[model samples]
Target: MKKWLLNILQCIQDIYQILKEIKALYNQFTIVTAHLQTIIRLIENYNHLAEEREKTVDTDQHQREIKLLDIGQVMKILNISESTYYRWVENGELQPRKKGKRHYYYLFDLQDQIAKCKLKGRL
Candidate 1:
């Protein structure tokens, strides 16, 4: 009876040690997986930013005669609303493009106009 009890205790101790080791291994695997995922996300974000930068540089190179500014940029630069901008266009005050309900302004022309207007206003 004493021998049987000793063997049973030994078996329980062995199982406990195995379970502890398995839990530790699982924790380590999870940590490694999380770290790898974070690295992949960082790499993907960097790649996207690099591609965007390259495209922007290419656009800058090819566009020499005219640089275009979309509506939001126009408003921010001129401090005006869409209605006023369109009216100016219609009255032939500021030349612009109206294509598919989107307006675009020529960058260099707009800058010249802003300078003249600021000079007149002493602003």
Candidate 2:
């Protein structure tokens, strides 16, 4: 009878240890799940921002297709570097419109710059 009780007590202790391990695993799983949820939320927010940007770009493109030139377009048209562009802006040679964080120039302004360059024998 004594031996049988000792065996039972050992079995109970083993079960308790297994329960503690299970509890630890559950806590870890919960933490992982929370992190995954946060990641999912961040991705969703990024996607939403991307979609909004696409819509804004599409609208701007449609409205300013031929009238407005972005920095890259202006650079390509003038064959100038970014530093030169900013220098021109600083010198009051080129006036650009600001929308959000981007700068846009009018097609007429670019034509004027080109004519000035030709007159100065720079182009």
Candidate 3:
């Protein structure tokens, strides 16, 4: 009877030790899971930032491809004489991008000018 009781106590002690080890492993697993979640969030944020940079690059490329117009095309679009166009240029109301001896204008710039003129009731 004494031997049987000792064997039972040893079995209980072994189970207790196993339970303690399992609890420690569970705590470590929780910490590892938290770290993994943080890493995933960082990766998602990096991907979002990369997507934004790509969009900015695409917009810059599009702007580079924007059409440039000459003086005659600008005069025809604005329906103004060459003298009036030159006067507006001298007045700083029209700014043209100059390359060597040629002056070029962006369509977007002309559209903005038209919008400003409309706002002032001049168009």
lDDT by residue (1-123, candidate 3, tens digit) is: 699999999999999999999999999999999999999999999999999999978876776588889999988777678998899999998999999978898776687677766777656
Tell me the TM-score of each prediction against the true structure.
0.51, 0.53, 0.56
**Model 3: per-residue Cα lDDT at residue 59:** 75
**Candidate scoring better on TM-score of 1 and 3:** 3
Superior candidate under lDDT, 1 versus 3: 3
What does candidate 1's lDDT look like per residue over 1-123, in tens digits?
699999999999999999999999999999999999999999999999999999977765665456678978876677778797778788887877778888787665576667866877733
Ranking by lDDT, best first?
A: 3, 2, 1
lDDT of 2 by residue, 20-105 (tens): 99999999999999999999999999999999999978876666666778999988778779999999999988888999978998
Per-model CA lDDT versus the true structure: 0.80, 0.87, 0.87
Residue pairs that clash (backbone atoms under 3 angstroms), model 3: none
lDDT (0-100) at residue 81 of candidate 3? 85
> In model 1, which regions exceed 4 Å deviation?
65-123
